[model samples]
Every structure is written in C-alpha cells, then in structure tokens.
Target: MRTLIRGMLEFLRMTVLLLFFMGIIGQLENSVVKMIIGREGYDGFRFGGNFMFLIGDLLLFMVFYRNYLQFRGWYTEEAERLPKRVTRMMLGFGFACILLPITIALIL
Candidate 1:
C-alpha cells in the first residue's frame, strides 16, 4: 500500500513536470515559428507544431525516465508524510497546471 501510494505521487510529479516542460517548449516553438515565418497572427494548427510537440515531449520523456531510473531506489522506499511546505507547493503547481492554459488562451 505504501509503494502504491508512493508510485501514485511520483506519477503525479512526473505529470506536472511534463505539463510544465511542454508548455515551455510549446511557447518557444510558437515564438520561433512566428519569427521565422514573419507572421504575427499565425495561431492555427500546423503540421510543424504537431511534429514539434511530439518530438519535444518524447525527448522530455526520455530525460525524465532517465532521472527516475537514477533515483529508483529512493522512489521505491516507504512513503512518508509530506511536509506542509512541500504539500502547499505541489498544490500550487497543480492549480497552475489547471489555470495556465486558460491564462494563455486569454492572452492569445
């Protein structure tokens, strides 16, 4: 049961990290594409953007997997209670994950 809980928490951590990185990569891709094509209003779906997301996410997955492997022993240990500060921070990021897309949509 402890391992199960720990795994779930670790999965949540990975997911949050994935979303954060994807957001950053996506913004960078948009900025670069806009600059290269010299179009300020090119905000529609494009094949290149899809390709970028696929490749960038795959690369990030590999990196995260490698990091997980490096710390596999720690992750497998018995789960313990999280400190209040850590819990708060995780909740904050979780809320950010929920709000970020809406904020971006409003901005763009």
Candidate 2:
C-alpha cells in the first residue's frame, strides 16, 4: 500500500518535471524564441503550438499539484529505492530545470 502510494507520488513528480521542460520548449519554440529574434506577430505554427502548450501546461499543472504538496514533505521517500543511474539522470534533469531560466535570460 505504501509502495503504491509512493509510486503515485513519484509519477506526480516526474509528470511535473516533464511539464516544466515541455513548457520551456513550448514557450521558447512556439513564441518566445521568435520574440527574442524580433519576429513580429503569430503565424499558424505558433498559434497551434501555443494553443497546445497552453492546454497541456494547464492539465499537467493540475495533475502534478500533488507532487508540489509532497515536495513540502507531506510524502515519504523512505521506501524510495531508485537505481543509481536513474537517480543520476533525474538529478541531472533537475539541474537543467534549475539552470534553464538563467540560461534563457542570458541568451536573450
């Protein structure tokens, strides 16, 4: 039962991770990238991409809200046993998330 709950929590966490990354991708590729490059106005590509991104980001934000609560220590990592390689990959991705905004700001 605990493992089941933990698995759900982990899923929530990863879903959050994926959403954040995709939000950045969507924001950059669909809109901000062109804005930074001095492109004016939206095209069909940006329109469709931003539309999808808005819907996806909204849904994912709702779903992963549980993990946000868990991040405050409402959930346990006691029985969490991830493979070292997986953990390393997660850590690396987390680092990338941390750095993304900074990198983008510097670039633009």
Q: Which candidate leads the pack in TM-score?
A: 1
Segments in model 2 whose C-alpha atoms lie over 4 Å from true places: 31-42, 46-108
lDDT of 1 by residue, 23-56 (tens): 7766775676566554553354343445444554
| Per-residue lDDT over 30-61 for candidate 2, one digit per residue giving the tens place of the 0 to 100 score | 46535554553334332243454455444444
lDDT of each: 0.54, 0.51
Write down the TM-score for model 2: 0.34
Worst 10 residues of 2 by lDDT: 40-49
